[model samples]
Target chain A: MSHEPRDNPAQHREQREPEELHTPIGWPLLVVFLGIIAWGAFYYFHDLLSATGATSEAGDRRSVVVVDPTAKADGAAVYAGNCAACHQATGMGLPGAFPPLAGSEWVLASKDIPIQILLHGMSGPITVKGSLYAGVMPAFAQLEDAEIAAVLTHVRKSWGNAAAEITADDIASGRKAFADKSTPWSEAELKDKVGAP
Target chain B: MSLSIAFLLAMTFLISVGGLALLVWALANDQFGMGQQAAETIFAPGEVGEVEDPATPSAARAVMQNARKAAHQASDSEELFERTIADQSSRMPVLFWLSSSMVWLLLGSVFGVIASIKLHLPDWLVQEAVLTFGRIRPAHLNVVAYGWASMAGVGVGLWLIPRLFKTALVGGHYAIAGGLIWNAGLIFGTAAILAGLSDGLEWLEFPWQTDIALVIGGALAAVPLILTLIKKRVGHLYVSAWYLIAALVWFPMLFVTANIPNLFVGVDQAMLNWWFAHNVLGLWMTPLGLAAAYYFIPKIIGKPIRSYGLSLIGFWALALFYSQVGLHHLIGGPVPTWAVTISIVHSVMMVIPVIAVAVNHHMTMLGSFRLMLYSPTLRFVVLGAMMYTFASVQGSMEALRSVNTITHFTHYTVAHAHMGLYGFLSFVLFGSVYFILPRLLDWEWPHAWAISLHFWLVFVGWGIYFWPLTLGGWLQGLAMLDPARSFMESVS
Candidate 1:
């Protein structure tokens, strides 16, 4: 610690000059910071304008899109990057090793089961885009609430399937039910639950 | 526009030009002469005191005075430095504390709110010139980055550099003038934006009229610093000074280069515009803020940096690498390949400095974990430095061709920006403000609850805000790469 500079213990001791408070405040810094605040207000309004620029896409279209939240690119990316690697991009997964997404009725036919299947992925024989594919689809329960919702949405939207959106809130509800990712889903486990559609 | 309105607008532009002239004049004079000596001579008046004492006119006296003047100048150069420790006992505690932290905390909080809400509800409010996300986002950023952080950073820098170097502020006049211009510009610029007249670029959103006044204010602010350095007693030239000086140089360049509107005639605006804006975050603000953390943390705790050479490499590399960091952003854009290639290369090079600075900061805090138990400054700064490391790694990753494939222009970049600026730079500055407030004000902060409240609101708000963006960005990035996807399909 030879290069170490020693602190004077006396320096740490307190003093009481309630009067030296007028140590010339900096004008330039104030201007810079304040300038930024004003600058931000400009964008607040500008962003408002940019938002309005696309009036058609704001409200109604969003609802239709949200209905298939997996349609969310972020959500879908998670699905494709992680899930699709095995689910065989088509969802008509490999007969035994992976499941096919193409025309799988399970994805289109149900809402509640998909959430369950997504949260605690199916390992035993399960139905996907259609035919009974017996493969272990890893549980994504450990994924972030948003990720879980997104993957479920992607599967629902892709491969000629149709279903309601899987929102973040729905995933949160599933999280409350199962916090860990170890459990695998059976068809019976998802046989009765109903998603908000 | 009416003649009167036109006149007012013209006057604003005039003010900008006028300030730039003053800045250039000061800079030019500095090149030819040791102009900074004027402030030091004012305070010490060493030889001038005795030389002028014999008021009688005599050549012999004048020659004798010259010899003494040279000696005094030589001696003054070898300073017995003091860390400009404020008689921390000063009582104007409220004004000092409030000006530095309270003002910015409030400003930052407001912008934080808007930033979060704007994400989900881009069209939640009126779609006027004054209320667009584009205008408001930059305005919010400038306020947080400039309005709040810069004020507080300079306030702390004003006090701390002197202390660390064992010196005091030399010119109150310059400091005071700078303060006025800075505040007036901020108020006017913020108001103008609220009124819906913004230039509509990131950080450079402040229209030319107000920006000019702020630059004038900045030069005035810098005077005391130039004066203090000349008066500095230490030869050690601590690492913090390096960080600060880099910031001072970088900010003006960012503003001058970015604000040169004629350069952005029509089509090539975005390419040039983003270059300036992104670099400001990379070079100007972050360096100053991080430099403060490096100086204060160990200065207070009583330790040497884990590696001095590493600190040097980090600082110099940051200066070099940061200048070309924005190009990775436009990797897939129509900007020339060379531009994108250099930026991406520097962005990757950015990793070296980031790690070096982080190691210097975080490792120094390793044994001083006990300080975090009692010192709020250490806690905030440590957190900020940690964030600096986090965000930087993410930046390099995003710069990579492969990784950018998944993160570019998505919520991921948004999150990274926040993590770097707000998470690292802003967080550290907040701590610096809190620490300096007590030292300058003489009394301890009256409202710890308020302080805690401020920190929590910012922390939680930021987490809630940035996390979603990263997740969403990743998905968006994936969708963009899918060739089958159209614009509507990608966002959808």
Candidate 2:
């Protein structure tokens, strides 16, 4: 044992354990932790309990609604689920691939032109806001007439664009007009038939 | 789902409150007031008795007595305790756990290498489902985090805690059993993961059945440590003991809470997943690494810490702030904005403890820069401490919305993780192993060249692994943000 201690210098060095200082300052630190928890709880419950009707900055871009209150809410929901991915929540669509619904001449032109586009999709080169976009817009003819009306109404009134609300009657008329159309409409065909705004 | 969320929140609340209450009790009882006496306890002769020598001449005996008295007045108890602790137990269980940790480290490294190769060569292992990137990646993560880092930490803790508490290990057999069971669990869990029977959660990828084995194994292994703590000869709980014990307690609670079958669903499951994942690092691995650094740095340097107060702040702040910061992983995700916001706030608050730890360590090593040259342990530990500070500050910044916007889905996050787990935690653990092995095994390292080689290889290897990923990943993120750049352009 003596030889062992002699061989290992590390073992012979004295351990210097620090004196455990008495510090009363830890209470305030604990308070900070508690405060954070309280704030988190408050925030969580506030988010959960509060209704979605609060007019947020996000909602400001899509405020126009002259339809039934239920229809407006349904339209917002429909837009969020179906159209927001490519066209974006603000309807300020992707730069090259998707065309913007916000401030689009086609959306604000007339109910028939937009309704026609919704019933029979559009394709090929098209100009939106002075940019040439060659993209395919899929048809939403499978949507209920009321749903089509609500969503179109949402797009038309949103993003500072004011237009008359498209109704179920208008969607029904557009569907009837494009009943025989199976494939997407070409830009030339859309312009020839529906006419540019 | 809501009930589980409430349960998790309640658990966090209870832990915070319980910890605070312990502090309050300690304060009110003046447990900290007898610092000098408590510091001297390790040196004081135990009730077991000491041998007396009466054969010496009067003059020689007088000189010897005076020398003994002078030595008692100084801080020589550390040396006495060291010898006592080393000689008390067989130290076989610690060796067993450490050996198991090394095995896992090698296994994990193999998995990690395979996983990394598959990243660039996706078709290399496409033939077998077991070898697919998805399975191998999770296995690598689990093995390294739970299998390597954790086992190594526990092994080190088993050896270190008793020495700190100045008590003989009470449950050596139980600890060995625990180590075996833990390894068994890891083996089965890794196999199950490879078989694609995963639970589909990050860090909790082990199915519930496998988790049971781990939970049991961990509990068994913790028995001796807890017992040692209970029968501690010292009055004051050292900072290292606080970290080690808290980690032991925190881990089982975290493991059980996060892995309960079908306890949460949808986004709530996601929330709990991140909560568990982040805390496993913050609470478990981080504490172990920090605890090692706290112990070895001072022990090797043979000095008291600069500020015990800062150490307490560091420990408590880590406990409180680290628990909630996990939700920052889900920023810009489907989870609620409020949850993400709170997580961000908590993540930023991590700076308090990081700085506390940094200042304490920095001030302790203020004039001892030359120790890094001669002491292999100091070199590794000091590097680890520096990396810890760097990794944590980077983590805080990364949690911010501005930085996360670019770095969120990039390899930058991966680089950051490696910096933490491998660079910081693993490095510290390595230092601990180097320092402890000699004492436990009663042998010096066979070759100093090997250690030097290891230090350079790992240090350089980490630099190579980390910098490219960070810079390249940042560039990739920038490219991804631009609509004009093709996805392939960013990837390639």
Show the colliding residue pairs in model 2.
Answer: A15-B78
Candidate 1 lDDT over residue span B79-188, tens digit each: 21132133221113223423844575587667666756776676776457666666566667777766776776666566655654555556646766677788788878
Candidate 2 lDDT for residue B169: 82
Worst 10 residues of 2 chain B by lDDT: B47-56
The DockQ figures for the candidates are 0.02, 0.08
lDDT of 2 at B164: 78
Each model's TM-score, in the order given?
A: 0.58, 0.69
**Candidate 1: segments with Cα more than 4 A from true spot:** A1-11, A14-197, B1-101, B127-129, B266-268, B446-457, B483-492
Using TM-score as the measure, the top candidate is 2
> Backbone clashes in each candidate structure, one number apiece?
74, 1
- Residues B1-492 of candidate 2 have per-residue lDDT tens digits of 244554555456456546645755675566666454555464444311111111122343244334334333443444555455643462788899889999999999999999999889989988989999999999999999888999999988887877777667878888888888888889989999999999989999998898888998899888888787788877677889889999999999999999998899999999999999999999999999998889877665544577666687689878877889999899778776657765776787677678778877887877666656666677888899999999999999998878998998899999999999989998998888886776666555666768778888999999999999999989989988887789988889
lDDT of 1 by residue, A1-197 (tens): 01122232222321111010111213443354235334433432343334333533222223232356554447667867887777666676667667666566566655555667677777677655445666676666667777777777777777777777888888787667666546686666556443321
